[model samples]
Structures are given as structure tokens and as C-alpha cells.
Target chain A: MKKTLVILFVIIGFNAFSQTANQILLNTYNKFSKVKTFKNKVHVDFNIPSINIDTITGKSYYKAPLKFKFKFKGIAFLPKDNPFLIYNFIKDSTKYIAVLNGTEKVQKQNCIIINVIPKEEGDVMMAKFWINPNTNCPLKMQITSKSNGVILIENFYGKYANLCLPDKTIFTIDMKKFKVPKMVSADINSKSTKSKDSSTKTIGTIIFNFSNYIVNTVINDKIFTDK
Target chain B: MWQLTKIELFKIFSKPRSYIGFSAVTAIAIVIQIALYADGKSYWDFLIQSLDESFQIENLTFNGNMVCFILLQALIVQMPLLVALVSGDAISGEAAAGTIRSLLTKPVSRSKILWAKLLANEIYTFLLVLWLGILAWVVSLAIFGSGDLVVLKSDSLTIIRGADSAWRFIAAFGIAFLSLSVVVTLALLLSVFSENSIAPIIITMSVIILFTIIGTFDLPVFNQLKPFLFTTHMIIWRNLFDNPLPTEQIFVSIGVLVLHIVLFLAITFYHFKRKDITQ
Candidate 1:
């Protein structure tokens, strides 16, 4: 009878732990969703070993339900979809199978790791999030996609920790893995032998530094429209 | 030879058809510049949509340098037709006008006359490219102002600083002139075969169109054949924008183009030299 009681208690404890991990993810998502509008100054640094480029600085405006506009003076190279993917995933939590992968230290802070597998087939095949247990914020995220390969993003929080907004985000992408069909690659095929050799070893990284975040600011939808 | 070439140039410039190339270039450049000035932001946004999520661009100006690059891309394809219009008619048009017989009756050898015509065609090709450069690059700069040049290729995006891009444009135009010379020579060769100006022009354009199609077609069969096509080498001007600037490849492309020019010239010379003008 005592053995049977212990077994029941153990099962309850396991279920409780599972629920706690899921609750943490929900809390993080909820915290991030609260900011309806935000305007911030951003500085971008592209660290591409194969190419040379200067730092790009710009102003970015974001509105809830996916309206984003960036105003800049110079050319900037960036991944088009991953930022939205991160926001979309957090906004719609029901589409993913989130499971606790246990605890780990992220940036020397204790965090709970969650393995998220998409329920429906989409661009994102799977994603892993390292959530700061105390603040219920994502410290780091690794997303794997069929088309875009793997994207690793590290988030650095500042005064807006409570709001789940990062002051900076660093994105790393393996450029060599990105397959561009010959039809689309401009005139690279004119020097195909040389280009083929160099493309295999290239890696691209982009860093976003955000400041002066004015949250809940009124921004017109027309500003986001392509002019 | 110099006197003969001079006479040929005078004859070419005297014709009203010679002005068409210059007019077309200017019209196209102005139209494109105006359109870009009016609605370029929306067009650029669509192009950069894929990269927008990660990078925030700033101070993205549409200046003369950018316009020049765009003009080159849009106009290079059409430039061959302009070249063919004059060059394809070099011999055939003379024949059709009954001037070839009188010219052959002179003390000058057929080979020397052919050289003079080719030399005159080369000078015309050089002037046409220079006119395109002055109008497209220099005039656009005057209108739009100067800024960095951003080039978007299939697999990569290259941004060249405003100050550094001038030399690249010069080199690109130089290479473009060489490629156009190949077209001129090809047309002249075809001109040797016919007495009608229209036939040579049509034949030159047809050959170029066919080769370009074969060069661009993604089929496995076409892939092997692409390396051999002069049309494939024609776009090597774009290579100057590549980060490392594939020097060897550019040289090879130039070598191949020069080879095509030589071959075309040789055949035209051979056919003209042995021809019976009396018949």
C-alpha cells in the first residue's frame, strides 16, 4: 500500500513539473505581447567574412499584429523572415508542441530550456528556447527551418526585462548552406569555378543594437506602407 | 589606310541613321531616371523585402552612380541592335546603293578596303559607348547627385562606395565596348554575305538572340554549351563588382571575346578578298 502511494505521488510530481515548464513559456509570451507599439533607434553590424561592409544605423518602428518599418540611409543586408517568425511563434503558442528540455545556464544566468516542435508543417521545422526562469523571458533561441537552415539568436535584456524586450539581438546564419539556384545568382556563373570554391566557406552574422525604445507610441499604419 | 578610314567615318556620320543610337540612349536614360525618382522607394522595398527583417538600412540614396549601373543593365542588351544597325549595313548597304562596284574599281586592294571599313566601325563603336557613358553616367550624376552603388545579383548583394565605384564603371564600360565590338564584327561578317542591309542586321540579331537563349537556359545540355557562347562572355563586365574582382576570369572573358572578334574579321576578310565584284 505504501509503495502504491509513492508511485502516485511521483506521477503527480512529474505532471506538475511539465505544467510548470509550459506555464513559463506562456508567461514569457504574454509579457512580450503587452507592448502594442514601439519605436527605437537601431544600429546593425554585419560580420561577413567573405564580404566587406560598413555599419548601418537606422530607426525602426513596430506595431502589434506584424507591422514593421525601418528607415535607413544606407544599404543593409539582413535575413528577411526570422525576426517575424520569432514574434509569430510567441504570439500563437497553440501551434507548437512545447516540451521542457530541463535547466541550463544561459549567459551565466539560470534558465529553463524548452524544445518546441511545430504541429503544422511550416518554414520552421523546430525551435529551442532558453527562457530566463526568473523574468520569464527568452535569453536565447535556436530555430531550424527547411529553407533557411539554422538561425541562432541571442537576446540581451536591459531595463525592459519586465516587458520581455531585448536591448540587443545577434543573429548568426551559415551563408554556405543557403542554396541559391543558378538562375537567380546574378552573373556569378560567369566565374563559376572561383565562386563555387569561395561560397562553401562563407558565414554571415548580423548584430542589432536597439536603444531609445518608446513603447505604446502612436504610429500610423500608412508609415509602414511601401512608398 | 588612315585616309580610307577617315572617308568611311565621314560617310557614316553624314547619314541620319547614325543619330538614332544616341537619341535612343538619351531617351531611355531620361525615362528610367524620372521613373526611379518618382517611385524608386517602393521598387527597392520589394527587392529588399527578404533582407528587411534582420538589417535596418539607412541613408539609402538613389544617386547618379546607381542610375548608371541600372542604365548599363537595361541598355547593354539593346546596344547590340544599335551596333548591328550600322555595322551590318557597312558592306551590304554600300552594295545595295551600287557604291561597292565603284569602290572596288579603285586602285585600293579589297583587303585594305575591308580593314579601313573595320577600323571605321571600331571608332564608331568607341564613340557610341562614350556617348552612352557621358549621357547615362555623367548626365544622371548631374541630375540625381552622387551616392553609393548597390548591385543585387541572384545569390549576393554588393554595395560599392560612391567614391570607389567610378573606376569600376570605367572598366565595365571598357569591357562593354569590347563585347559590342564582337557584335559589330559579327554583323560586318554577315554583311559580307548579302547585298541587302536588312538581311545582315536580322541575321546578326538572330545569332545573338539564339546564343543568349542557349547561354541563359538552365537545362543540363545548355550548361556545357554556355562556356563556348560569346553571349556568355558578354556579361563579364558585371564581374568587376564582385568583392575580389575575379581578375583571371575577366581576362579569360576578354581573351575569348577578342578571339571571336578575330575569327569574325578573318572570315569576312577571306570572303571579301576572293569575291568577284563583276558578278
Candidate 2:
């Protein structure tokens, strides 16, 4: 009778800790979703080791519920979907299972690590978030997707700590594993006769430094539409 | 010899057909420039789609050097036809007009007249290429302005600075001239076997088209045979744009093209020297 009681208490303790971890994740998601809109002056730097590409800069405007506009002075390349999609996924608990893995220190701050597994079949297979326990903000996120490979993002929060906004975001991508159309790759291969081996294994990194961010600004929806 | 060449040049320039090549080149260049100017952004987007996820390229200008490179790639394929039009008619046209008999009746040897005709044809080929350069490269600079040249190949994207690009263009054009020389020689050799000017022109074009098809066919048998085709060497000019230019391969391609030209000219000389004019 004594042994049975001890085992039951241990099981209850494990369940209670798991519930507390889920509650913490929910709080962090709510804090990030509070920002309605923002406009930022951004400078993007790219470092592609295999293919020599220089750094680039641009301006970004973002609104709540998936509105993002990026304008560059000249030719620019970006992913098809907005970067903020990760945040949107976190805010909604219906489509994903978020579990608290453990705790770690990021930049001398104690952080709670959460592993998010999508419920429905999608491009993103898994996403791991490292959240600062004090501010309920994300310090780093590593997303592994089915088509685009792995994307590791590290966020730096400065004076916008209260608003839960990042001053800089660094993205490192595994380009070789990214799923592009076979036709595009074939076309490029046919024309290029050099560096055939190196191009297939390229890894690229992009750093975005955000400045003069105006949070909760009223932005027209027309600005996000393609001209 | 100079007088014979001059007469050949005069005969070539007097015909209205000579201007056709120049006019075609100019029109094609202008049309392409206009098209690119109007809808270049969509083309740019299509090209950079693979790199879009990683890089944010900005301030990339569609400058004259880049335009010239594009024009050269598009125009090189049609240049053989232009070369064949004039050189193919050099001997056969004279035969059709009964001028060969009159010219052979003179004290000069048949080989000398052949050499003069070949020299005149070479000069004409040079002028045609120069005119193409003026319209495609020089005029494009006037319109689009000068900047770094961006060359997109199947596997690589190369950007050549404005200061460094001129010498590469010069080398490319020189290599292009050598390639065209092979076409001219082949046409001239074909001209010797026919009495009708149209027949030689058509035959030369047919041979080029056939060879090009064989060279570009992506089959094991064709790939093995491609090295023997003179048409395969014609695109050796593209090597100029490659970083750390493959000097040995470029030289080999040049050697092959030159060998083809020499063989064609030698065969023409051997047959012409032995043929009886009276028959």
C-alpha cells in the first residue's frame, strides 16, 4: 500500500511539471502576438561560402495577421513566405503540439526550450524555440522543414525588450538541402561548365539588422499588395 | 595580286545583297535591346529564383556590357549563314555569269585568282563582324550606359567589372573571327564543286545545321562524335568569360577549327589546280 502511494505521487508530479511548461509556452506566444504592426529600416548581409554573393540591404514593413512588404533598391531575393510565419504558428496551439524539453542559458539569460511538432502534414516537420524565461520572448528558433531543409534563426533584443521585438535576426540556411524545382537546377547545370561539384552543397547565411522600428503603426493593406 | 583582290571586293560590294547582312544584324540588335528594356525585371526574377531564399541582391544595373554579351550569344548562331551567303557565291557566282572563263583566259594562274578571292572574302568577313560589334556593343553602351557585366551560365553566375570587361570582349571577338573563318573556308570549298551560286549557299547552310545538331545532341554516340565536328569549336569564344580561363582547352578548340579550315582550303586548291577549264 505504501509503495503504490509513492508511485502515484511521482506520476502526478511529472504531469504537474509538464502542465507548467505548457503554460509558460502559452504566455510567451501571447506576448509576441500583442504587437499589431511595425515598420523597420533593415540592412541584410549574406554570406554564401560556396557561391560568392555579397551583402544586401532593404526596408521591411509588417502588419498583424500575415502582411509583410520588403522593398530593396535593386534586385533582391527572398523566401516565398514571410519570416513571421513562425510566430503565427506559435500563437496558434490548435495545429501543433508544444512540449517543454528543458532549460538552457542563452546570452547569460535563463531560457526555456520548447519543441513544437505540427499536428497536420506540412512543409515544416519540427520547430524548436529557445525562449527567455524573464521576458517571455524567443532568443533562438531552429526550424526543420520537409522541402526547405533546416533554418536556424537567432534573435537579439535590445531596447525593444518590453515590446518583445528583435533588434536583429540572423538566419542560417542549408541551401543544398532546400527543395528547388528540378527544371531550374537542370537549366543552371546545362549552362555552367565549372564548379559543378561545389554548387550542389552550398550553405548560406543572412543577417538582418533592424533599426528605427515603429511599433503598432497604422499601415494600409494596399502596401502589401503586388504592384 | 592587289588589283585582283580589289576587283573581287568591288564585285562583292556592287551587289545589293551584301547590305542584307548588316541590315539584319542592326535590326536584330535594336529589337532585342527594346525588348529587354521593356520587360527585363521579369527575366531577372526568373533567373534569380534559385538564389532568392539566401541573398538579397540590390542595385544590379542592366548595363551595356551585359547587353553585348547577351547579343553575342544570340547572334553567333546566325553568323555562319551570313558568312556562307557571300563566300559560297565567290566561285560559283562567277561560273554562272561566265566570268570565270574570261578571268581564266588571262595570263595569271588559277591559284593566284583563287588566293585573291579568298583574301577578299576574308576582308568582307572581318568587316561584317566589325559592323556587328559596332551595332551590338558600341550602340548598346550609348543607350544602356556602362557598368559591370553579369553573365549567367547553367551552373554559375559571373560578374565582370566594367574596367576588366573590355579586354575579354576583344579576345572573344578575335576568337569569334577565327571560328567564322572556318565557316568561310567551308563555304568557299563547297562553291568550287557547284556552278550555281544558290546551290553552294544552300549546301553550306545544310552542312552547318547538320553539324550543329550532331554537336548539341545529348546522346552517348553524339557526345563521342562532337569533338570531330568543327561546329562544336565555334562556341569556344564563351571560354573568355570563364574565371581562370581554360587556356589549354581554348587552344585545342582553336587548333581543331584551324585544322578544319586548312583541310578545306587544301582540298579546294588540289582540285582547282588539276581541273580542265575547257570542259
Candidate 3:
């Protein structure tokens, strides 16, 4: 009887934590779901060790759900992932199980950390979020996907915090960690070799600053269709 | 001095061999442009294939700027040989044809005659580089249109905007003129010693090839010798395309090339003044 009582307490405590995580995600989702569409002017600054590109200005378009596209004036090296797709994943609680990890300080705010794993097999394998419980805004995110590997994003909200939209977003990509075809085959003697070429993996950061955001506006589906 | 140089220029143009440099440069530039036009996309795909997995590289267009850069790299290597063909034959060909004795017997001093020939050779080298500039830069722009230049080295890739590229091209051509001028003086110096036109031309080419080989490999012994090689400095023009241009390195290369021109001219003048021409 004592052992059964102990087991019952453990189940109740675990359920409480899971419910708390679920409630936090639901509030964050509700904050963002109000926007049916948005058109924003984006200014991107690329900071990569290997690449030499500086700043490029573009327009970012978003429709209901997860459609996002960027149109830059010239050649740009950028991430392929849809930036808004993370919200889509979290909003549907049936698709993923969220566990409250703990609290961590992000952008001077004590943010709640939640780890999410998809209940079904899909492109997204796992995701983690650092959410500001007070504002229901995601201050930081780590998304692991089948196509893009591990992408770490930090969102800084200002005038758009009420809508849970970031005024600035920093996307960091580690090229070597991608689960894609390798650039070159590893040399047979690479293990013992002291000399190596400089073409090895490196980190690339793309900082996107958004302004003149027109939300809940009409967006034609033509731009979202792949050419 | 200008009149003497004009006569020497006339002599250079009269020879059929002088046209070879101009013709070769034009033909090679056009051929490269044609090949690129037909299927440059595949070539670009292969070059950026490694980076594609990590980046969605938007608007890497194959345009005039890229074509011109490619042409410059290809044509610059063979330009010295073309220059050597004309400047190499300046004195030795006159000697081989028994015209040097008559040419020397003219009222001009040996120093004045040599200087005139040097001036003419310099002019020819300048025109050839200019012709390459026209075909490689101006013509390619006409054919392919304009866009940013994406230069892919062994380990790095640089994207130079179309707006910022004009000055770099002009600077590279100016440097190419300086580089080819070194070949002119070296060939003339060799000409002063040889009785036949072919020897100086052949010897100058051999030296260029030898130095190029030494500069290419980074062996410990060769590293010590690289700074002295004109071939090593000839590639300094490429630094213009780099972000945060290495101004010091460019100046050092220009200084080295100018020194080579002075040294070769001094030896050619000294040897020609005392030579027994009656033989």
C-alpha cells in the first residue's frame, strides 16, 4: 500500500509539470495566431567567417500558417527554413509533447524552458524554447530538423511583444552539423594528418531586423508557390 | 626621343609577329566567352555544390564581371609569351638579318637607339594589355551584361558588387602592363647577347616558366626564393578584388617590378655599348 501511494504521488507531480508546459505553449500560440498575414521590410546582416557579404535589404512575406519567403535585391546566402514554422508546430499541442525543463535567464528575463518532441515522424525531430512567461514571447529557440540540422534562433521583441512577434531575430547555423551530403570525403589518413585545409565547417549568423510590419493583411498565394 | 620611338614602333608593326599577341588575346577571350555562354550554369553548379547544402545562395548570376575575371586569369599567363615574341625579336632579329650593322651605322648613339627600342617595346606591351582589357572587360560586358563578380579561390569565395568592380579592373590592367614590361626588358637583355631572334624569345619564356613553377609550390627552399621572382609579384593585381585591400603588399610588388625593369635595362645598355658589331 505504501509503494502504491508513492507511485501515485509521482504520477500526479509529473502530470502537473507537463500541464504547466502545455499551458505556457498554448498562451504563446494564442498570442501569435491572431495574425492572419504579415508583410515586413527586412534588413539582414550576414556575419560569417568564410563569407564576405555585408548587409542586404529585402521584403519578407508571410501568410496564414507557415508560409515565409524573402526577396532580396542581390545574391544572398541565407537559411532555407521557414521562420514562422516553429509557431505552427507549438500551436498544435496534439502533434508534440512538451516537458517543462526549468528556468533560464534570456535577455535579462527569467524565461521558462520547454523541450518538445514530435509525437509523429516528420521533418522536425525536436525543438526547445526559452519563453518569457510574463509576456508569452519566445526569447530563444533551438530547432532540430531533418533538412536544416540544428538551427538556434533568438528573438528580441519590442513594439510587437503583444503579438509575440520579434522586432529582431538572430539565426545561427553551424554548417558542419547538417545531416546532408558532405562537401568532401574525409581523407583515409585524416586521422593522423596534422595539416588540414581551411574548408572545414564554420558558424554563420544572419541577423534580421524587421520594420513596417503590416499584419492581418491580404496576401496572394502566388508568391508562396515555388517557381 | 619621341621621333626615334615612333620609327621603332613602325619597325615593330611592320613585322607580322607583332599582331600575334593582339590576335591571340582576342581569340582566347571570345572563345572563353562563347563556352561560358553555352553552359555556364553547370560550371557554377559544380563550383557552389559544396556550399548549397548549407546555404540557399540566391542570385549567383553568370554575368560580364565574372567572365572578365576568368578571362583575366587565363590570358595573363600567356601574355608574357606574346610580348616576348615581339620585344624578344627587336635587336636579335635585326642582327640575324644583317640590319643591325646598318641600323647602328645610322647617326644615332647606341644608348639612344636602345632606349627607343625599349620605348617601342613598352608601347607594344601597353597596347596588347589594352586590347585584352577591351575584349575581356568591355566586350564581355556588352555580350553577357553586368552583375556582381563571385571569385572562387582554392579555399575562399569573394563576391564583389558590380558597382565596386570598375576600379579594380582598371587597376588590374595597369598592374598587368607593369608585369608585361618586366618581360619586355628581360627579353631585350637576352637579345643583346644572342645573334638569333629565336634564342631570346625562347630563353625569356623558359625563365618565366621556371620562376612560375618555383612560385607555385610552397617548398621551404622555394619560399626563400619566391620574393625575388617577378612571377610571384605578377599576381598582386588579384588583391584588388579582396575586401580590405592589402595596400602594403601591392606597393611592394609594384616596387619589385619597377626594380626589375631598371636592372634589365641597365645590363642591356651596358652590353650593347661595348659589343663588337662588325662580326
Candidate 4:
């Protein structure tokens, strides 16, 4: 009778552990997937020797899978591309969620890993998320997009709480993809050819840190619409 | 002394050629305005669209904002040449015309005559600049209609609110006048050395263009010399666009300009006093 009781106890403990792990993965992803609903500040750093842009600052805000806004301070947008700070490019039939290949690693006392890929080919290419195994919360993410290029984002440095959102976050850009359309203009192109051997490039750097972010706050609807 | 100077001033203004500078300013302002109006939207839209992916901006109301700023942008590189056309030729043109000989024969010292010419040229320059401010900014705003001022720098876009732009425009022109005056004064000094009006005008413009190229080249040699170049000081007007005034740099520019004025005027007077006037 005692042996039978031990076997039943072992089975229940195994089931509980399985449920917890799945719950942690799902909860962390859900919180991160809702990124567009929050107000956050981001810092973009870029360097390109060809066109000579080193670094600059810009802010990002999002409404959902379809609508997003980016505001670059002191930088003007070129005419060929869309210039809205918040862009809504999601189509009606587009998928919003997908499970990507996951990688595992131990961070401090907690073990966590994540895998994610874009639902569309034209959307951001790769996004890797790091979740705390014990707390079931996402702690950081590394993202790369074809449009803006590579970006690194991490939550505010603090102990992760179970199934809770980050209080503060920081976003950074890799600078390779930050391009100005005017750099490709005919005037610059001709000048480039003339001084093909003489031109020397300067690199610029910019860094930004975000604090006191409030998620699910009331954002104006007009921010997403065209004038 | 003042009376004689006033007569010379009157003579300069009474000539139809004096009005040419003002007329040219008006003509250029109108041409640029028309060109901007025709394609201003597309130009603005193109700029906004380029970085839209990074910064998803929406509902940027043009309402003549971008056009007003474009006018100012054009002036930064163009207005000094206009200033040189008149102020640079003040003494040189008179010498080339053989009018200086007749005027010098009057009951006046060479120094006094030089002062009169300088004063007259300065007055003309100030008036021309004021006229330009009115036509380029005020009249254009009226014709184009008032709105925000959208400024485009290398990597950023700055918007000055419409309500804030009026005073900003006034301040910008005020700073622009000070800068142009320095150019005018330098041209006046050059005019003293040349026999032909065109030569002084051309030389002054060449000097400015050369310095502008040097300032922008990013060479280690130029980086050291940039602070000393008058062209570097010429763009002091642009600093007013910053949220807070860059007072120290502005003061430095003022000091540099004042020093140039004094040095140029001193040289002009010394040269004029000893000049044989035989030619």
C-alpha cells in the first residue's frame, strides 16, 4: 500500500512541473507580443562608412500588429519612403503570432530561452526573447529587422517577478540599417564619383535609455491615421 | 561732417542702381516661392516617407510650414552674394566710373570722404537686408500663408510651431542682418583696394565660398581653422533655432565680426589718407 502511494505522488509532481514550464513560456510570450500597446522610448545608434552617417536619436511607439510610430529627432525623412512616426502596415489576413526555434541558457539562478520569427517575410526578420524559467516572465529581447536593421532591447535591471511585465526597458539600434534616402540622391551620387578616392567617412554615435513606461495607457487614435 | 556724409548718402540712394539690390531680392524670393509651391508637397512628402519605417509619424500638417523654412534655407547661401553686389562695389564702382575724382575735388579731406562712402554703403546694405526680410519672409508668408516652420538638418527634422515662428523669423532675420553686415563691411574694405566694382564683388564671394568649403570638409587642418573663418561666424543666425539660445557662441561671433569691422575700417582709412589719387 505504501509503495502504491509513492508512485501516485511521483506522477502528480511530474504533471505539475510540465504545466509550470508551459505556463512560463506562454505567459512570457503573451506579455511581449502586446508590445505595441505600450508607450516606450528607444535609442538608435548607426554607422555606415559609405554615406557617412554615424549615429542619431529616435523614439518609437506602437498601437498593435498593424500600427506603429517612430519619431526621429532632428532627422528628416526622405520622400520615397513613408514618413509617419507610427506606421500601420499590417494586412487583415496576416498572422500575428508564431512559435520560432528556441535556444536555452542559464542566467543567474534561473534558466530560460526563447525562439521567434516574423509572421511575414517583409516584417522584422528575427526576434529572440529571454524569459526567466522560475518567474515565467520575459527579461530581454534581441531584434533585427530588414527596414530598421538590428536592435537590442532589455528590461530594466531588477529581479524578475513571476508573470509580471518589466517596469523599465531600453531599446537600441545596430546602425547598419539606418539610412537616409538623400544619401542616394543624384547630387551625392555624382559627388561620390568625383571624389571616389578622396572621400573620408565620419562615424556618429547616439544612445537613449527609457524609464517609467506605462503599459496599456490611453493613446490618441489620431496618431495612427493619415491626415 | 555729418552734413557732407548725408549728401553722399542721398546721392547713392537716388541712383536707380541702388534699387537693383532690393529688386533682385524680391525677384529671387518670388521665383523660389513659386517653385517651392508647385512641388513643395511632394518634396515634403518624400522626406517624411523615407524615415517613416523608423519613425512612424502621422498627420504632419504642411499648411505652408515647409515652404517658409525652405525660403530661409536658400537665404543662408545666397544673401551674402547680394550684399556683396552693392556694398562691395561702393568705392570700387565709383572709382571705376571716374566719379570718385569729381567727388574728391570737393571741399573735404580723403578720410571724411571715405567715412561718407562707408556710411552710405552701410545704410544701403541694411536697407537691402531689411527689404529682403520683408519680401522673403513676410510677403512670402502672406502669399504662401503662415504656418509652422519645418527645418531639415543633416539627420533630423525640427518643427517650429506657427505661433512661435513669427518671433523666430524676426530673430533669425535680425541675426542674419548682423552676419550680412559683416560681409558688407568686408566687401567695403575690398572695394577700397579695387578699381572695378565687379572685381571686389567677385573676390568677396570667392573668399566666402572658399571658406564655406573649408569649414565643411572635415579635414584636421580645417577643423583647427574653422573657428577663425568668417564663414563659420556667418551662420550664427541658425543657432536661434535651438530651443535655448547659444549665447556664448553668439557673443564670440559678435566679437569676431566687430574685430574684423574695426580692422577693415582702420586699414581703409590709412590707405585712403596716403592714396595719391593721381590715377
- B-chain TM-score for every candidate: 0.96, 0.96, 0.97, 0.88
- Worst 10 contiguous positions by lDDT, candidate 4 chain B: B50-59
Compared with the true structure, model 3 gives a TM-score of 0.91
Question: Quick one: ranking by DockQ, best first?
Answer: 3, 1, 2, 4
In candidate 3, residue A69 scores what lDDT? 85
- Which is better, 3 or 4, measured by TM-score? 3
- Model 2 lDDT tens row, B109-188: 99999999899989998998998889889998998889767766654565565777899998888888898899889889
Per-model TM-score on C-alpha atoms: 0.65, 0.66, 0.91, 0.64
CA-based DockQ, model 3: 0.33
RMSD of 3: 4.0
Over A1-227, each residue of candidate 1 has an lDDT whose tens digit, in order, gives 99999999998987787677668777887888888888889998888643456677888888876887777666666665536347667555678777789889988999999888888999889899899888988998989888777888889999888887788888887555223344433343343324545435445788889899999999989878854
- CA lDDT for candidate 4: 0.60
Report the lDDT tens digits of candidate 3 across residue range B22-112: 9999899989999989977787777677578777887788899899998898889889999999989999998999899998988999999
Distance from true position, residue B254, model 4, in Å? 3.8
**Top-down lDDT ranking:** 3, 1, 2, 4
- Please list the C-alpha lDDT of all candidates, in the order they appear: 0.81, 0.79, 0.86, 0.60
Candidate 1 vs candidate 3: the TM-score winner is 3
**10 residues in a row with least lDDT, candidate 1 chain B:** B50-59
**lDDT (C-alpha) at residue B68 in model 2:** 91
